[model samples]
Target: MTWLILISASLNALLGLTLLLLWRIERRHAYVRMWGWSWILLSVGLTLGVALAEPGLVGLRYDLQALVASFSLMGSLSLQVAGARDYRGLPRGRGRGLPVFIAMMVVIVALAGIDQRFAVIAGASFLVVGAWLCAWWMGRGGDGGERFVALCFVAIGLVHASGPILDPFSRSPITHTLGLYVQMVLSLGLLLLSVRRAHAEARRQAERFEQLAHVSLQGLAVIQQHKLIYANPAAMTMFGLRDEAHVGRLDLQATIPPELQEEARERHRRVLADPAARIEWEGTRLTTDQRRLYVRSLSSHLPWDDAPAELLVMIDDSSRQKAVDALRRQALHDELTDLPNRNFAVERLRELTGHGAAPFALISADLDRFQLVNETLGHEVGDALLRAIARRLCRQLPPQAMLTRLGEDQFLVLIEETRDRAGAQAVAEQMMALLETPFAVGGTELYVHLSAGIALFPQDAADGPGLLRAADSAMHRAKGRAGAAYIFFDSAMNGATRTRLEIEQALGRAIAAREFLLEYQPKFAAGSRKLVGFEALVRWERPGLGRVPPVDFIPAAERTGQIKALGELILELAARQLRGWLQRFGRLLPVAVNVSPLQFEDAGFSARLLAGLQAQGLPHEAMEIEITETAAIGHLGRVLPQLAHLKSAGVHCALDDFGTGQSSLTMLRQLPIATVKLDRSMIDPLPEAQAAAVVSATCALGRSLGLQIVAEGVETETQARAAEALGCTQLQGYLLGRPLSAEAAGELLAGALSAV
Candidate 1:
């Protein structure tokens, strides 16, 4: 019996150490630590019982041995119950059970002092209850390992319960041997349960990872040893693979383009060498079906099957790249002509003028009379004509030159390596010569002309904008010439440009100050020399400048859009003067006011003019609107409607500067006019046979149309007589009367009425 007790103590000690080792490996299993302490306490209790049985062998007090053995047995049972509760995830009830356990230990110690047999029975009762509780807790909803542990505890409780019944006075070898076997079985069951739970958790985690990879949109793949080991659904579709089997057979290097294979190998080496490496790149790849794809991919290191591997995520970027390229082109190129636009020209100029650059020339070209084509033949034909012109210019350009459209009717050319003014001039001339030929547009043979200006680097101006301005100014100067021409920029043009700008600015102030006045030039009958009507002319006198010539300011006013306001002022003064004359003399002579072409483009011009005349309480016939032949012919579509409206309202309309325009016969026939004022050029050469014949033929044409012919610029009596003999009904020049002030004209009108 003593040997059995020693062997059971050793076995319990071994089981306790094994459980403690398992607990150290997995600290989260705190119930294993509690169970290990319970086994250690049971081993000490068995050892104490052996010493109490033979005090001579251990040389210890019998009473002390019996008391410690009783306490150890109770402590071991309490711990078993607590550990069972912990394993079942239930509260240990330490606060309620602690006093009860102390009372049980006190009763057992008191019982041992009376008789050792009573103490042993008391301790065995506690073992029976605690072991039964463990069995019930462990077996409830338990697996195979937990059920086996419950059975072992149940057998242990029965063996200890019968030990006190069978031999209450001595130790039982059979009972101790059975307890050792039960404890060993419990430890094996615990180890089995822990391993099974770990395997189950691992399986659940793997399933979650598989589901996430299958549903991901980004292409995901794993490459090991330069061969495809794993591929998700997205990766298989991206590479045009039929199934997972297809992906498994493919080599990673085979999917890459031949030119990019070396790059891929280098990247793979980097990923394997450093576990934290992440590489991002863009390249082309070949699909399984031999289709090329533009892809952006991210590569990073991944551990797969306990070995280093590469993980790649890819995105198709073909469409996005193409869209970006298309947007860039639209921003820099002209939509209509498909050429580089002004923005592109400016950017190129900036690049060329950076730090140190070779000398280049900028040529500005403007199409002459392009507006006339648009107004006459329709804008469709005009657009066609511009396209034709662009194509011709491109064909004529040298390989080193670039042409860009600077908006409507304007183009810019850049020539590199231009050495001097002559080089620029030659290029401009060559470009201009390409337009001398007629272009067939919309079934019409249209002749086009170009006016070009040349500005050189380090010669005309310094920077891009300055060069552009210089070229534009020179172009305007060339446009002022008689025919198609090209000119180089000079310093004098800048002064002229500045002066024009000053005039434009001052004109705004003059209009506000009302510093403008009207002068009337009297018209007379060719035969009777009788006063007929007057032509009201606008004249400006700045307070400090005294007077600005009409030629200098009129063109500026028209160009700067100041003519509209000036025209309104002239209408108001003329209407007021006519009203004053009618009140004083009880008669009124018609006054002709000149209108600019731009003013007629206003949709409300006729309505505004009629309203003004009516407001002044004057008849419509008291105001005759005069338009130049060039204005009437160039903007015939816009001028014709206004003329027709005024003619219907009983207001007279006359074509001024008639013979200087291109189509005199067309204007006479199409325009609703009451008179035709011959230009000074036609009358200047009058009385000459050829000039006389031309004037005579014009007068006959006018008379046949029931129109009055007024010959202008008749300086001498011979010219006046020649005009009268040539079937002229009216004459207006210095010979008849000079332009007079409002006061002088009013006195002259009163004198004429008194004479009548």
Candidate 2:
């Protein structure tokens, strides 16, 4: 029995030391520590039991030895139960079990002094109960190792129970040896349980990592020693790899573009040097199929299979980059014409005018009568026409020149290396000439005209915006000319534009303040010098500026669309003068009012004019409308109906400035006019052979058509007499009488009537 106890103690000590080493390795599992201490205490109890049975061993009293060994055994049993509870995650009894167990042990020890049998039974009972509790706790939710440990505990408990039954006073050699073997098996099972748990936890973590790598959207690759080792699904797809087999064979150098491979290698070296270093860059990558991919990549040092490796995370940024590029293009380009817009033009201008840039010409071209096309045709056709014009202009541009659509009906051309104003003017002329050929749009042959303005860099203005403004001003000046024209920017045009802007701003206030008046020029019958009628001319007398000439403000008013209001004011003034004359002399001469072509464009012009005459209670025959030949020819379709309407209502219509325009005899025959006024240019050179022949032909044509002929600007008697001989029905000029105010004209009319 003593040898068996010593052998069991040796085995228990060895197992305890092994468990303690494991606990030291993983301190978080405190149950291992507890189990180890329990085994050590059991070993101590067994050794003491041997000493108690052999009295000469330690030279202590039998009862004392027995009591000490019993206490050690009880403490070991308590620890075994506690360790089991902890391993199974069961709660401690909050220290109540400790005091009760201590009291029970004390009682058993006192009784053992009187009867050794009672101590034996009580100690054995304690061992059996504690072992059973451990078995229940460990086997409840335990794995194979823990269950095997619990079975060993049960076997050891039964052996201890048999020792008390068979030999109540002395230790039993057979049962003690059997309990020692079972305890050894239980210790081995505990160690195996710890190892199994660790292995299972490691497997679970690896599985989770694998799942994440497969599902990740970013391409993840591990490279070691310049060779691809591992790649996730995303990485395989990104590089056009077939599977893991393909990735294993792929070289890291092959994935990077040849030009960037050296840089990539340097970056990899840096990343490996510092484990915490993360390098990011944007570059092109080559796929398995030799396709290029734009990628934003991040490279970092990582550990793979216990070796240094590089982790490359590539995000496919190709789509995002393409979207960004497309958005940039849309921002700078016109969608309708697919041409660079004003924004791009401004950017190009800035680039061209930078510090070391060569001189360039900025040509601003505008389509003439574009609004007329938009109004007459549908906007669809207008858009097509603008696109066609843009194509033609683009074709005509020189290779060094860039064309950009500034806005509706306006294109800006930038010609590089332009030397002088003449070079710029040449480009402008070429661009304008392209529009002279008709464009076929929507099955309609459309005749488009262009007005171009050229401004030289560092000559007209220094910078981009200033150059554009100078060119635009020149373009407007060119637009004022008859047909397609190109002009160079001069400093004088800026002053003229400013003055025109000021005049346009003041026109509205001028009309509202009644700062205008009309003067009448008398027209006399050439045969008898009898008063025929008077032509009403509007004059402005600004308060502070005195009189502003009609030539200065009239075109400004028309351009600014203030002509309609000014025309209404003139009509009202004429009606009032006629009313006054009727009240004073009981009669009035027919007053001819010059109407603007813009006014004739209004569909309601005749309605508004006839309504005004009727509101004054004046007869329609008391007024006549005079339109210039240019107005009639330009807006022939629009003017014809309005003129016919007025003529049918007994209001006479006359074509003014006839010989100065390109109106043909056919156009004259088509007009609903009662008279044609020969312009001052035609009348000034009269009585010369060529001029006489021209005048004679005009008069003969007029007589054949049975239309009245009036010669204007008849400054000399010979010219007036020649006009009369050439069949002039009426004459009006400074030669007869200058323009007069309403009162003077009224007095003149009264005298003429009194004489008759």
Candidate 3:
């Protein structure tokens, strides 16, 4: 059927043009456009002979027949080039060599008019080469679809090539008919190849998405009908499973904690029923080993296994998230009392004020004489007392009130949801009663009183810090009164506070300006009144204020950290004086310098002190560190190590204000002190039977503990005699020699050179 050949050519040209228009619209594949052009060439070749019966074309009919064959041959070659360009990403222009091939084909077609058989053989060779190239190019792509495309090219090309080859040898109708069938096969093959490539591309995209899901940190899994269809490594690890099989084996509902499983099941049912529904649930997961782990899971719809599926994402929120919360708490809470610290209190206050909260009260409570507990009993006992106080305060506070430690012996109570000032007073009184009870600290029953200051919202200075300051000023006013009590903030309290702050500021400047000088109080042998070492007393001389009493600044300095720096200055000054004394007297006697507990806690205290002494050519044994009993007990543990270090370094240490502290015999025996400075209170009542008994017992204890007993604050002859009879070895007070300036002290030392 030559008509069939013509029809096939017409159909090929139509298909080519349709595909060309489709490619322009879709731009799906690079090979489609070239394949369309090839089909157009084949249609042109078939059409060449379809109208050959015209008289005008009768002389050129053989030439036209060869031209049709050449066109058909080149069309097949275009298909081969199209395959290469599509599969290998090669350019169609480079691969086809279209214009050169067309020129050569036209020349060959012209020569074919001389010998028709030669043209048939040449065209068949062209078909073979083109078909093989197409097969090879398509083979370079992915498997399955690519293999079929290659096979189609080979089969169609070989079939069409055989027609031209056999036609040259035989002039049979069967041989001519074979080309029509081959053309049909070619058209069908091209459509099949395109279809296969589309399927391959879809499969590749699915693979790429799967790979991306596999590497994700979130536990990703696909579930169809509550059975796992796929699981990534994270998903498997989250479920304590080995593979997809394990994921399917474990029932999700059963894996959740029993109490939470009901909600989880309901959520799952709702999500599965709707398919588009999304749900997030945070719950505990039960491991195979019966351990529970916290996890937050999110489930949403996804197309998996060719159906609507569930994409499950599990995030482990147990250890990591809880650790973050704990760190946040540590930042807010006090390490010792586990109470909210100053920062947390301020933040809470800001929150309350930001919301314009009303009628709340902030009470600043400072424990009165708390330092004595620390200094007498040691820091261990002091910390225990504070923690006990915190617990007690927290227990006693009203429901809406929050208690926070503002460091040291100070605490803040915020009545967040109070009604009026009466409600504030009720909270303050409740806290006061809590402190009224005796607390067992370091094996001793102790009573701590609170001096509380109250500042109300809107009534007092606005804002957190300002309100807290007003409360603090009121607290100071309360302290100035007879007993432990609470006072409301008033306008005049601010003036007192400002004055105190100014004094504190001035003290800071005085130390920096080296405006302090030391006065040495001579110590004597109790019985002989023989000269011994002198105690170094720090005296501050303000420019306009003259000499501010030690009573005014010493306590303030002790509360602030000015004591540490001031102690360093005093120690350095003392070391320099010792060097000068050593040169003057041909000997260096110990000059006792008072050390605050805060100063003793310095990590570099021992090293720095020794270095300063060494730099001044002063002997470490020529100076003694006098620490109050109250200060000593507060930092007992820290002091022990440093004290031992000082003893090893040939430095002297003594307990000052001896009997005032809670520690009596234990510290005397335990600490590496060379002397115990008996508090003036013990000797002030001297010569009385009771006072004598106390002094005798204290001195006996000191002697038994291998400690030197030096009675301080000896202001009378009777006190000195009592101290001597009470077994005191050294005496210090105004009775023997008042605290003297360096020049006066030098003169006294020179006068007492014979006695010394």
Candidate 4:
């Protein structure tokens, strides 16, 4: 037992010394770590007095053990005080009265040494109060280990304080020995507990280190003074490192390109000192003879250490980003010409307009008759021709210019920063010159032409799409001229296009507005000066626009897709006119109105037309539909069946503007037409070389096919004589009479018939 006493005393002294060193040398607190050490020493002093001596100093030992137990209780209180200082929620150093009580018990024990029940009673009371204070400290929830130790101390104090009071009643050495042994065990337990707590804390530190090594979106690494300490999985993969073995072999400088080393090092140094600093390593790629890595490294000094300390270097590969940029480029631009596609071009124009960068100008150009080349030669030749034209235009265009290939034959140019109209005009002239040269494909020469249009920003048009429309309108203006040419966008073009758009929109309300009116031109027989038929022509007498000629609004309606409604209205009006004429005159003379090719191609044209005629109670034979050569040739499949259905319904068909386009003697023989109207261009000259030959040939072709020929555009006597001499069966134009209003035309028709 004395040996046990010595062992306990020695261990206690060692623990106390250890705590003092950690508190003083390491500058750590004494409450949690050092306070536990104080309890170990106090427990040892109690055990030695009980276990040593011949009779084991029974009376002396009990009193001494009481004193040591009182001190041990104070250790837990000290722990609570230190914990409160650290956490701020627990009680501070406010247990001043407990120290006075400890002093009082020490004084009482000294005065009545052994065999003094009163002093023992006083010491035990002090120990109980001290233990209660320690328990209160633990109830505040300090560190887990310190709180557990405090709880054990409270229990030890309560049980052992009862021992001295009960020792006098039943003086058993074994009972006393049992109490000493319990002290021995608890001291040893606290020491073992302290060791285990230290081990656990070390393990937690390791786990945190591992977490930092792996926790980041970017690849993280630890590079000591530009040398690799560790490479995270992300960093290894980013730098193309196969494994840790690869990482162990290289440094940061070795992985980065030579040109980027100086900048990378400077950035790394800056980030290490200031945690907020972010450094971008510009070019971090490996060469053929070296390993390449793209890394944007951020370095920071850890809390525990400093020099060669640790760096949080991040590595990122930019090659995937480069590939993404390339893919984006390919998506928005044409592959062959490397020009912007329609979508990208429109988007760029919109962005420019949003910014209001400059006075932008848009030029739209379409290769005139480019489809003829594709149809006649081949698609490959056509493609070559387009590429050749594109290359030529690209070379001639200004360096700052942006060009877009809108379609097969259309090109759009955005003049972003043009100096003046002169600059735009100069660019247009350059384009024309480049395109004028003949393109040689398959060892054969082919010529190409372009009709160009210009639209200015904020003046002629407000935005990008509006500017494109303005340019398109200008191009149509150029197309109407004799030769293919370019024209600058003018306010006049805007006025005209706006007027046309208004008419097209108003066409829907024409029947409701009563603005739509029909006129008739008389058709006469060649030999007999007798009335044969009347040609009904549509004209719009708009309120403000005055008389909108059919030549102007009719073509605009067709282009704007409003002609379907317009054509239907014309037919309804003609049917109404025919009904009136037949009801009043008691004669069913046929009336012909020109139907556009687009109107004839409508699938429901027949049903709608027949329904209108039936509604007006007009005979089908008294109504005639005149179709142009272009309509008959373009949609021949849809037009022929529609014409046959009309003829089957007892209606007559006339081919208008014959011998002008693809019209010839062969097509005339196959068409369902009963009459052919010679084109104005074909009837302009006669009895004079070329004009006479054309008229004679057309007349002969018509006669051979058993079709009646109507000579059109005869304005003077000379033209009438030529048409008459050509054996034309019918003639129409100003020579006979101009197109008159419905009332006037009715009078004219009545007068002619009365004379006949």
Candidate 5:
């Protein structure tokens, strides 16, 4: 047991010496070095003092070792407490009082162990003070690793206080060996924690410096009074300053040329007063011995100490200002035409309207089917057309005519001091005629029509915004009428426009009022006279309005975005009727519904339709939808995808009014449609041989493309016979069946089924 105790104590003493050497190397890290040095001394002192007390070195030398051990423990404990508390703030002074207390306690303990008379009273005093310090740390809300350190302190105090009574226990070899091991391990753990914390703090400071350097865009330099102390890499290149020694002695004023010295000083003072504000200064710099630089520097001050400050400066060469000016010009003008854009147009209008003068007329013009021109000839040609139109209009305009391009296909012309209503009307006609002239774009002759709306100054509108609005409204009215004619803004036109807007708003509310109903038109097989399918047409039976024509309300609904909700409502009604028909007829005939162009634009249209069908528990194949060629061609790319998605989901797509569309048969073939319905006009004069040949040709084309051809608008047996001769397998019109209500259509199908 004695041998084991000696071996353990000796090993601990060696470790303590190594730690003391490491502490000397890292003395600059005060918290870590202090704790580490204290641990190393404690370990060595405890090992030697405990070993010597076992009765070999019997007197003052042994007492001195015990004294050294006590002082080391006290020093190490106090440092551990301070390092833990250092999270709040670093502690000051050497902490000499703790060491003094431990030294007096150690002397008293040595005397008590030697059986001195006053030893007991002195030991009691020392023990009370040590215990008070441990309790004091505990009372200050000690927990975590810090609480463990405090507990070790309390244990150490109790051990020393019980020294006289525990003479027998202290003499035991097992107790001394175990006690020495525990003390060495505790000191090493506490010292390692302190070292970790110091390293972490060093890393945090480095990170803060890195963040500051990253965030600053301007060149930064720290100067001490008149001399530069440090310059960041940006500062070095910005001012063309040399190395650190040059920066250390360089005066900032030396960088500015003599002529600009006063301006530089004024800007510098402003920066010093407000570090956040940018201060501009122009000065010449010497690029080399012979070359001189004319530089403009935007600078700000970053003060580090009260004695001196640093300046963060951004330098731009004056020669590059041309590029900056180009960017500013591009922002205000249209890039395609290099003309003053909509932003500039609005400003020009405001400036023109500011003057109180005679009548001036504002004319707003839009190119008819301009989108079609772009689609057919390409955007390059479209731009060339616009530029040519702008040049032609410029040539025709009087000196007072202010022409501004408003949008992609719209332009605004402000003519000041127009000759009353007749003169204003004549100017608008001339402008329209000039716009209609052929534009030679990329060697292609393009004919474009212009719709112009004239709003007279001080009468039609009193202000710029109002004048623009009136012109825009009148332009719509002009386009609504036939041909290339210009219309003056009038109150009657405004009333009609307001009525359309009111109708659009009313159509939105009609869907929720149960005013919408399904009117079904039955499809016959022509040969068997059996009902094959029913076309689902929507009718709005408003409470006071009675039955509204599909033409009037449908177009209005489509234009005003009431179409999507209306389409969904119609689909739900059709699906419900189909389900009921299937329940009664014992077999389901596909229901054909119509979809508007705007409805197809929604990305979620396919998913919503499929989910609605699934919710109704009806198979998707039981429904077929008709899309107009106008709608399909309006957004070909988006519509093609939407059609493909519907086809993939087992729904049928039919192109309605096939030949009436501008899209050729080749374009139609590219679409994934299962059927094509010949327009009503084709069947109107169907008995005529020329019309029959056209129908036959269409039917042959449909057959070649594997598309089912349904001939619509068959009015008589002669028309039906002609359609049959043309190989039309399905015929639907007033001849076979008119559009019927849900119940009437159901009864018609039932009667037809009975006949079959």
Candidate 6:
């Protein structure tokens, strides 16, 4: 028994020395270091007790006995702790472990005076520590190695607990032997734990690698010696291949397109030669169904997998890149014509400017009859015409010329270099000639014409923005030409344009400030030439600006969308005048106010007109609205509904300037027209045998349509009599009475009522 005890103790001392050497090599776990010290102490104390084990021997050191007792218990406690910690990677509990162990050693030395009392104390401490270790490992349902270690700790704990009772049955040598056997068993458990721990670590690492390979967004793969050592699930999906055995063995070049194989090879070479290099490419790959896929591939150096290798990460940019390209097209091109838009034009101009391509000519063009086209036909036809014109202009333009749509009905042409003004003029002339031939648009043979203005670089102005401005100013000048013609930029045109812009600003201010007034032009019964009603013509009287004619400001107002407010002001002023005339003459003659297309299109127009009538204490019946054929034809859908609403409210509507527009009597039947005002052109060809026939025919048509006919621009009595004979009862012209101020109109109404 003594020989066995001695042999086991020596073996434990060797195991402890091996642990200490392993800890010094790699101090990964602090618990291993603590257990090593414990084993060494236990081995040394047991060795000293054996050497001094002669019973009743003289000079038997009491301190040596106490040390032996304490070291034995402490060694078992350390084994229990090491197993607990190894099961779960726990931190070193209480950083004061070393100091606390030193203090315990000092106390044990002081207790050496007691007989076996220190052994009892040491046993109790081991019981508590071993019990905790048993609980920890017993709860772990995993790891067979850990369960085996837990049972070892439990047996040692039981032995320590029963030490006091078992001591009565045995002496110190017997108990020491039992403790040696337990330590030897604990050492074997540590050996099994170490072997199992290495196996578990390898298994866990393999599982994590498999998860990464199966569930990753990027197509990850490691290539070694021109062969794929690993291919993740994403890699198979990206290459559009099934997870076949051959796929993992295929080289990178085999997966790429034949045309891109060289690129892939070069990329791999670059990554291998320079580990820091990050290479990327826009590549095409075949999908499972052989559908081509566009993607961007990236490659970088990967850690050596037994050889030089590269890591490839592929990102599919197919759908997202397509959407980005679509957005870019929408940004730089006109959606309707597919031509370059304003921004693209500006960018091209900048590019040209940067290249020192001076002495170039910029021509600005505007469609002359586009408004009439939009008004007579529809916006659909208008858009078709614009696209047709864009195509036609492109066909006639030279290769050096770049054409762009600056905005609606306006285009820009940039000529690289102009030898002289005639070179630019010749191109503009050719474009104008092409428009002379009518375009068949929407079943209508419509004539399309363009007016262009030419501005030379370094002559008209400098820079892209300045050249465009100058060209636009010249374009307006060309519009004032005899026909659709081209003109060069002149300073005077800018002045006129400036004055026009000033008038537009003034019109807006006048409407906002309520600074407009109305003049009355009376309409009479042609049969008796008696006063019937007054035409309300708007007059803008800016304080120092005097009177701005309706012809000048009305068009400006309509262009700027200030017509809605202008229409409201005219209604208000006309209502006021009508009310005053009724008070003085005791007659409520209807007042006719012209309505613009823009004003009629306003959704709030009817409500506002009715509100004005109510505020002025006037009936809707006393107000008549005169709309040009353009207004009715342009927005027929909106204008017809608005007319229906106003007619329901007892307001009168008449089609004014009828003959000037192309709308036939068929439109008159659809419209809610109380009267048809024959345009001044109708009277121009009147009072003659031929004119009388046409005039009488027009009146007959009006009568058949259930509409009253009023002849406009009647000057002579002969014309008035002819109109009356032709069945037109109402007549309006300067011959009857020129436009008069509101107060003068009141006197005129007063005299007429008195005469009646």
What's the TM-score of each model vs. the native? 0.62, 0.69, 0.55, 0.63, 0.47, 0.53
- Give model 3 RMSD, 1 decimal: 12.2
TM-score leader: 2
Clashing pairs for predicted structure model 2, backbone only? none
Evaluation by TM-score, superior candidate among 2 and 3: 2
Q: For residues 76-170, write the lDDT of model 6, one tens digit per residue.
A: 45554654665476654546555655566666556544544564555465455656565565447846766766666676665555545555312
TM-score of 1: 0.62
Error of 6 at 243 (Å): 4.2
What lDDT score is found at residue 98 in candidate 2? 85
Q: Backbone clashes in each candidate structure, one number apiece?
A: 0, 0, 9, 2, 0, 0
List candidate 1 segments past 4 Å from native.
1-128, 140-143, 158-181, 211-219, 224-227, 243-249, 253-285, 292-301, 312-534, 539-569, 581-590, 596-623, 630-653, 663-675, 683-756
Q: How do the residues 1-756 of candidate 4 rate in per-residue lDDT, one tens digit apiece?
A: 455445545655565555555446334333435454554545453453334323324455555665564455444334434542432334454576467646775665564465455554555555566555655655455567656656665765665566566664213354345445554454554555445655676788889867866675567677666667677876776767778887767755666667767866776677567655544444556632564444455556543345533455665546765676588888787776678888788888788777556787788988888898889888888888888888888877997677889878889888878747777787778888877779898568988888999887777777778888889998888777665699988888888988777777777677467678888888777766466888988878878768887887787778887787778878888888888887877776788988888887678898778888888888788888899897788888989888888878878899988877876567887788888898888888665778887778888878888888898888887887778888799878888878878888778778876775
lDDT of 3 by residue, 1-756 (tens): 556656666777787786677567547786777787877876675556332322223356555574665666576566656656665776666534767687668766765656655655666666667777877877765477666667766776666566554555323345445545655566566666665666678789989978877887788877777666777887777767866667667776666777886776666567667767888877678765556778888988787657777777888788976897699899899999999998899898887776566768899999899998878889999999999988877786777888899999999888877767888998888887777789987889999898999998878867878888889889988998766899999999898678667778887888889999899999998778878888999998889878877877887787777888888889878887888877898775678988888887788898888888889887779889888888778898888888888989999899999888795577777888888988989889888999899889888988888778998898888888878988999999888889999988887777777554
- All models: lDDT? 0.86, 0.86, 0.78, 0.70, 0.71, 0.76
Question: Candidate 4, which ten residues in sequence have the lowest lDDT sum?
Answer: 48-57
Across 1-756, the per-residue lDDT of candidate 5 in tens digits comes to 455546655655555555556557656555455445545554554455444455434478756765665555455555445543443343533576566656776676776577543454454345445544643554356456656655655655555455445453234554454456555554565555456656776798879876775465556665444456777665665666666566776666667667877775666566667657666665566532324555665665675755435364555463565566577677667776666677776776777678676678888888888999789889988888889888888888777777778879888888877847877777778887786668788887888898889898878877788888889999998888776768889977777677677678789778888689998888777666668888898888878768877877888987877888899899989988888887798767788999987888799898899998888778898899899887788788788998899999999999988767784777658899998888888888878888888888888888898888888887898888888788777888888889998889888878866765
| Candidate 4 deviant stretches above 4 angstroms | 1-218, 221-237, 240-327, 334-339, 350-399, 402-487, 495-515, 523-532, 541-548, 556-568, 598-621, 633-653, 662-678, 681-711, 714-731, 734-736
- What lDDT score goes with residue 568 in model 4? 80
With candidate 5 superimposed using the best TM-score fit, by how many Å does residue 398's alpha carbon deviate from the native? 3.4
Residue pairs clashing in model 3 are 374-634, 375-629, 375-630, 375-631, 376-630, 378-633, 378-634, 379-633, 379-634
